[model samples]
Target: MNKLLVAEQLVVGWDAPVTRPVSFHLERGEILALTGPNGAGKSTLLAALAGQGRIFSGTLFRAAGARLALQTQGLPPVAGLPLSGAELLALTGASAQGLPPWLAACLPLRLDRLSGGQRQYLSLWSVLASPAELVFLDEPGNNLDRAGRAHLQGALRARANAGAAILLVSHDPELLPHCDRHLMLEPIS
Candidate 1:
């Protein structure tokens, strides 16, 4: 199928289903927000879509030959690794132009040596700049400053403008406004 992605009454979780069956769809050039209180299975839903976690029920459809990338919560554990920002992006087929100027200039610096925000921004930009037709971003605004947040808004716009589909999980009010729509999950008791 040529569809971007479609979720029908999806229920996802780690040990057991954490979300109260929810449904949402995303198409190219569209940005959707996955929002809710903690423990609402927001991350799990992304995990299910990426075919990582257990899908207790419902179904997920991704277009055949579609590219996928998931920016999971928090920084990836790269401590003690000798990888550089530029090298990581190159490995992922992303470009440095997509990152903020400060981060872009730090291309040669070791990833483990960069500040938290720098690392977070680089990690996010890598996925955003990749050729991923479907991108899942989980709590992407964790350590971003006001300036970094602005860049994030621009990134979202840039991603949509480039004909990519984005499904983001964020509590940052600053980022929420940029989303075209949202799927709010209610916490299950």
Candidate 2:
């Protein structure tokens, strides 16, 4: 498998170091699970990898120009953005062919009208279907039902099979089985 990213004794934070020095790597066609309680710095590490936060210390490397996409937690509904679910998918070049009937129906509805699960599923689809080679997902299982999680599992597998490197944070036992590796984080301080 091709190596997509590497972190050597990496520490990340927004204003101050929130993660202890940690090391890890992500490879193509693989899923790396990031798990822990809140305040564990999982999201902060992701932010560093996505180039959104400070790499407070240590070294980080990526294969050439690895394209990265992030699906964050608690994305508020777009109350008046005038974007529909289908349009959102289109923006990411994602196809909703395998979506459940109810979710598929949401494709034409405005983003604000979709229920939480529908929006979460759609948000995940947008990233999984993106051209990005590396994807970072924080609490992807939020708002998803059993069926939605099943679909998410399938999608994660499909994306890995297609050679994308995934780093995801989720407490869902169902979703953990699909990952190739797991990294459990402990609370900072």
Candidate 3:
């Protein structure tokens, strides 16, 4: 299978290196889980793979047309927004026509009124709707209950089965079963 992403001798951190040199390959139609302690550079590695952070002493190769999807921790207040949920989804190119009943119910609510899980779902849906070969998710399981996590997992599987490579950074072990491979980041001394 073709490689979707490759990081060679990567050093990730804020100012200086927080982790050892990391190397890995993510193949197409596969999911790789990035796990580590709180300060172990998990997010930093994701950011580097997504091109959001600088690569201190290595190279990252991303397949052409790759897309990075990130679900941040908190849901920022979206009060006073004129657009409804459906409209927002539309703006992100997400197809809201066939969403599940529960998800569809959230279409008319504003982002501010939606629960944290709902916001994360919408964000993920937006990324899924986009035309990209690779997807990166950071802390995807945060704020999601069991059912919500199940729903997200199904969506992720569907995407992977459809040939999109996925890189997920999460703390929840429940997500491990969905991944094809795992890479644990170690903090640099």
Q: Which has the greatest TM-score?
A: 1
Q: Is candidate 1 or candidate 3 better by lDDT?
A: 1
* Pairs in clash, predicted candidate 2: none
lDDT of 2 by residue, 1-189 (tens): 399998999989999999888989999999999998889999888888888999988999899978888888877468778899889988877777767787887788899887777888888888778889998998898888989988889888888898899999988898898899999888777
Residues 140-187, candidate 1: write the lDDT tens digits: 888998899998999888988888899999999989989999889998
> Each candidate: how many clashes?
0, 0, 0
As a whole number from 0 to 100, the lDDT of residue 173 in candidate 1 is: 93
lDDT rank, highest first? 1, 2, 3
lDDT of 2: 0.87
Estimated TM-score for each candidate? 0.95, 0.93, 0.89
Question: Cα lDDT of all candidates, in order?
Answer: 0.88, 0.87, 0.76
Q: Residues 64-124, candidate 3: write the lDDT tens digits.
A: 7666655445554566666567877777566774466787898888776787778767766
The predictions' CA RMSDs to the true structure, in order, are 1.3, 1.5, 1.9
Using lDDT as the measure, which candidate wins?
A: 1
